[model samples]
Target chain A: MTPPPALPPLLDLTGIAVFALSGALLAAKMRQTIVSVVFFALVTGVGGGSVRDLLIDAPVFWVRDPWVAPVILMIAFITWFTPSRWWEGKMLDWADAVGLAVYSVLGTAKALAYGVAPVPAILMGVITGCVGGIIRDVLAGRPSILMRPELYVTAAALSATMCALGTLAGLPLFTVWAIAAVAGFCLRGAALIWNIELPAYSRDP
Target chain B: MTPPPALPPLLDLTGIAVFALSGALLAAKMRQTIVSVVFFALVTGVGGGSVRDLLIDAPVFWVRDPWVAPVILMIAFITWFTPSRWWEGKMLDWADAVGLAVYSVLGTAKALAYGVAPVPAILMGVITGCVGGIIRDVLAGRPSILMRPELYVTAAALSATMCALGTLAGLPLFTVWAIAAVAGFCLRGAALIWNIELPAYSRDP
Candidate 1:
């Protein structure tokens, strides 16, 4: 009858906030209205986790939590009122990397706690960490991030796989989660720093 | 425990097949590979119902049914192999209309059976019918059907509302479902025939 170990409140909020901000930033780039920005932020912030919750038959995390929606809306508002120039930097990419890493591990952990198989649980982690951005990009009428030759999903998969393996090996929760998240963050950081990309399918082929 | 009253197999298959075909048709229009066509077909066919199932905490519909995936794949294969000219015409529209109406009523009924409230259940119905197309359009990198001035989601809403109302009034399941679906079909059919559209938001105001 023990409760599952949860991600710290600050950490969870940081992940949600960063993702929400990224969504709003896309809206801003498109020069959409505030309403569209808010809508985008909400969807991108909640999309992945919502998909994961539904698949795992958990009551949707945001629907049950009071703070998540309001926090996303606040992030959207900030994105709206602030000058776009302030958001144009490598800082945004770094923040997004953190969110991806954290959410990936958390998603994998939650899926495992629900008794999902290891491989599917890892898939759940990727879904939780990345589906939101895909949803946002789609709504913005752009190519999905996944459609690009990027390390984004690969980073999430790495974190999820690490977490699943760590849990299976009966490692302590702190060690497992830290290593998983840091490993993902490091890989994503390298991609960003080095302008790395996966090879695209050759059109000639 | 008694089993839930299910939509007839033929009817369900017809809806799934038509939606899957529409999805594959879009892929073909984009000149994507057969694999992309099949992926699009499966996603568009199951997207809405999967969302409803997740929201209601029901085991995902397609995963449980052995027939659904293979049928969708067959539809995709047919679409990929056939000349696009064969799929051109009012027939595709007509089939889509049938799928929309049938899926909407079925979604509402399933939600109600699962103890969802009337308003949310009606929304679920609409989600079940239209979200597949939305997802398809998004993945295809086109404007969402919802963003257009057309009467698509509105038609779905009409059907869903009618179904909810009929159920609330204690009408027989068959009558309610038929009336609801026909109402939606007629509206959508009329839109298709007459090229009806809702007024777009004017920015000049």
Candidate 2:
């Protein structure tokens, strides 16, 4: 069987770095120790994909390739070493948005490649992109994004749909990735800047 | 395939009730809505075994049988409607211990029957017994049992090992389950009553 086409290494590295940074920043906010920060970062970078692969009976991607963990660790180390002030402002949010987009598209593409049906593939993409951060937040003793009224899940779902549509339209993988990434990033960024949230209903007595 | 030997229906119902109660209690502690409590109870009753079945490419037990969810939902509804005082004090703790023991042995026995090797079988048993609660806690925004300073994982590990060993030594399934359940109940009971905890290390420079 022919090997899968090569993905651009730089984009992959960027995805890992951004995800690791997102986890590390959250760990810092929670005042977790450096060890915990590193652990969270690694989990955020790869945990969702691992769960997806395990469920689908695929060999775990990180187990087959070791590069993912090292990149996560390096990002975690850098975040921990940097002064908190450097990340205390707005840059961290931007990184998180970018990470969410990249991971969502990557997850969708991977699921499609694995021959999952479109619905499951879309769900897999959302799970992969969002579950890591949810796990990180949960472990850090914070409410998950799912529990919050935020547009986090919405962004992920929309981005994954874009990826699935692009694949169905037979777009090149790189173009699909770019389009999905932009969609996710813009949605998340808009949510952050505009303070957008899903509407909620109070209990009717 | 010939149907496996029948388990006593009463015992199965008792186990499901105990597990469902524990899940409901945890959901209450997490301040979830009634809907969330019921969902948690259903998943906690069957999630671990479902995961194991999926891993081994076996039909998911609940999907095949459908009785599991109804049993758990009944327990959850009863718990929800009952006065808080009825479930308060020491009774809740006892129920939790019983649930832990029953699930642990049941998981190990199922794994062994599925022809998993000894080590993976034992691991699967522990994971199956413990992972549902872990997932419940995680999703409920509580510290996972793994991070708790308690004897939770240790109890599950010991019980699972005993179950695996008993099966390997050709003990009858009922006998193995009984022995493993006793071990788990005692361990967890001791941990709760005596406040047993794993050793912790200070990250002092």
Candidate 2's TM-score reads: 0.61
| Candidate 1 CAPRI category | incorrect
lDDT of 2 by residue, A1-205 (tens): 2243466777877877888888898887778899989998988887777766665455777776768778888888888898888887888778878878888888878777766656566756776787788778777767776556667777887889899998889888788889888998898999999998765422222
Question: What TM-score would each prediction reach against the true structure?
Answer: 0.61, 0.61
Top DockQ prediction, candidate number: 1
- The CA lDDT of each predicted structure is 0.84, 0.75
Q: Least lDDT summed over 10 consecutive residues: which range in candidate 1 chain B?
A: B30-39
State fnat for each of the candidate structures: 0.13, 0.08
* Model 2: colliding residue pairs: none
User: Candidate 2: which stretches are off by over 4 Å?
Assistant: A1-5, A30-33, A64-66, A201-204, B1-47, B50-113, B117-130, B142-205
Model 1: per-residue Cα lDDT over B1-205, one tens digit each: 2245777888888889988888887777666665456657877888899989988767877643657867887998888767877877786777778888888998998888888899999999999999998888778777888998888998999999999999889999889999999999999999999989999878895
